[model samples]
Target: MQVTHAELVTSAVSPNQYPQDEIIEIALAGRSNVGKSSFINKMINRKGLARTSGQPGKTQTLNFYNINHQFRFVDVPGYGYARVAKTQRASWGKMIEKYLSQRENLQLVFLLMDFRHPPTELDIAMKEFVEELDIPYGIILTKSDKIKKSQWTRHLSLFKKDLDLPSVDALFPFSAESGEGSDLIWEIISDMIEA
Candidate 1:
């Protein structure tokens, strides 16, 4: 979709604070430092729209960005940060679970993963959770420019084969630095909104 306008609407920690609109929401999910913020910034063609931090696990809230005022890009908090406390992590888990399982406006989830490696245990577990919840989602292979193309293909195949999610499209290689795959990602988002 042509991004005529994109702006941060709110940072929500609870469902009660989510935007009170039925607009379709496309959520971005990934581990800490997996380029989720970069992806959103690139997709919206707006620098600093999503905060990019050198420190992992800094995004501790559900960031909502209204796109064209038609739909929303929900940036879910990154998981599996080593420095985070166990109790904090558990709370994060519950928050994410509640949003994913019960959010009626959520239409699609873009699950980001590293391109150089196969899906990590956390990635696989998240995928399984989404499947069990019957949430529609797609895989996004972030930091593609960091890995060789051949290795990306191998890891992508491994992810699909191991997850038994062959019906879902192959990994979408993206690099916010290069703006690669930004258009394709936007196309997918538009399609979802239309559907």
Candidate 2:
């Protein structure tokens, strides 16, 4: 879908505070610095639309972006950052869990992962959460440019085999730098929005 106008609508701390609209929501889930923010910015063709940070755990809230003035891209705070206090991290965890579990408008989730590494523990946990909710989701392997082309097949194979997920079209190799797989992402997203 061509996003003619994407704007930051609100930053919500609770589901009750979310925009009171019926528009569908697509969530970006992943660990800190797994490129969730960068992925959103790239997909929407907006620089800094979803603030990218060199520092892990920089995004600490549920950021809501309205796209085409029609739907929403909900950026959940990245998990697995070690610098924050344990209690604070736990709070963030609860917040994300609540959002995912309670938000009725949430349609699809894009689980972001680094192409250079396997899915982390937090990634696994997020998958479990979505599965529990029976939520439709897709895997986005960001920073594909960091890895060689020949390694892509092997890495994806491992990801599917190890994750033991359902049929693997959900997994995609993406790169904000090269725009690899971005179109495919949009197609999947289009299908999701229509569904």
Candidate 3:
């Protein structure tokens, strides 16, 4: 899990643009402004590598980040930003669905959700979509530092019920600011890669 080398490999809009080296890919998916960039930065133990932004829907491509020359972290475009044009949103949706469904090397997806609120409609839809695709995935409750320790159980229970998350799947409470749950997250990723 020691990340000796981590760098952005490419910003790809299609399958032809993706890295062709046969590297395993783990994707990050979430709503716009849900801290997907921060999750990648925290995972790689680097700041500004994934480009955290105040603007929603900033990532328009599948960003491939090479990790330890072993696998890649693919940062998919964030969804549910109202300001984007309808055609553009449709394009993004198509691109995301294509990549998730067709990519052979894609090992797993980390579905990030804000810990402060209930799972949005888009979040539930995404969960169902991934399930229908039969893709291995985990639910990451981000911004856990903003919540109280006593409320963690209640929040987790609510998320599980709302998302209809299976009991066997992984769920981690994370904080990019505090580095909480980073190790456990890495453990899960490492296990997936090794398996």
Candidate 4:
């Protein structure tokens, strides 16, 4: 997609704070340190737009980025960060769950996972939770450049087996640093939005 304009529209902690326009929304969910901010920056073709950080769990709210003024990319808080207090984590979970279950304009969810390792328990649970909610979602395996090309098939197989990915769902291996899989990811997103 040609991103003529992209900017952070809001950082919302509650549904009332979300944009009230009729635009569609695409959400990104993953574990902490899964490079979600980097993914957002890369996809939008802008550096520092999503604020990549060294610290895990830095994104505490649902960051809404208006893309070309046509749709919004909602960066939900990352899960599975151990340093955060239990109460805080529980609150985050409830907030995320409520948004996922109740949002009507949410068209798709891109569930990010680390390509260098097997899917974590949180990742599996997230996949199941979204499916149970009847949310249309896909998996994006990030940091593909960190692994060898020959191992891609093995990693993909492991993900499918462990996650029990639905046949209708799609999975893409992505590398924010190398720009790999960016075009394909965009095509998928565009198709969903247009459909």
List the global CA lDDT of all models: 0.87, 0.88, 0.92, 0.92
Steric collisions counted per model: 0, 0, 0, 0
**Model 3: how far residue 101 lies from native, Å:** 0.4
Which regions of candidate 1 fall more than 4 Å away from where they truly are?
none
Candidate 2 structure quality by residue, lDDT tens digits, 1-73: 7889998899988877799989999999898989988888888889988888889998888999999876799
Ranked by TM-score, the better of candidates 1 and 4 is 4
Q: For residues 1-195, could you state the per-residue lDDT of candidate 3 as single tens digits?
A: 899999999999999998887899998999999999999999888998999989999999999999999899999999999999999999999999999999999989889999999999999999899999999889899999999999988998889889876652467899999999999998988898888
Please write out the lDDT profile of model 1 over residues 85-173, one tens digit for every residue: 99999999999999999999998888999877777889999989998988888889888888777676677677778767764474688
How far off is model 4, as Cα RMSD? Answer: 1.2
CA deviation > 4 Å runs, candidate 3: none
Q: How accurate is candidate 4 locally (lDDT)?
A: 0.92
The weakest ten consecutive residues by lDDT in model 4 span: 164-173
TM-scores of all predicted structures: 0.94, 0.96, 0.97, 0.97
By summed lDDT, the worst window of 10 consecutive residues in model 3 runs over 163-172
| Residue 143 shift from truth in candidate 1, angstroms | 0.5
Cα lDDT of model 4 by residue, 1-195, tens digit:
888899999999999999998899999999999999999999988999999889898999999999998889999999999999999999999999999999998989999999999999999999999999988888999999999999888888889889986542477999999889999988988897788
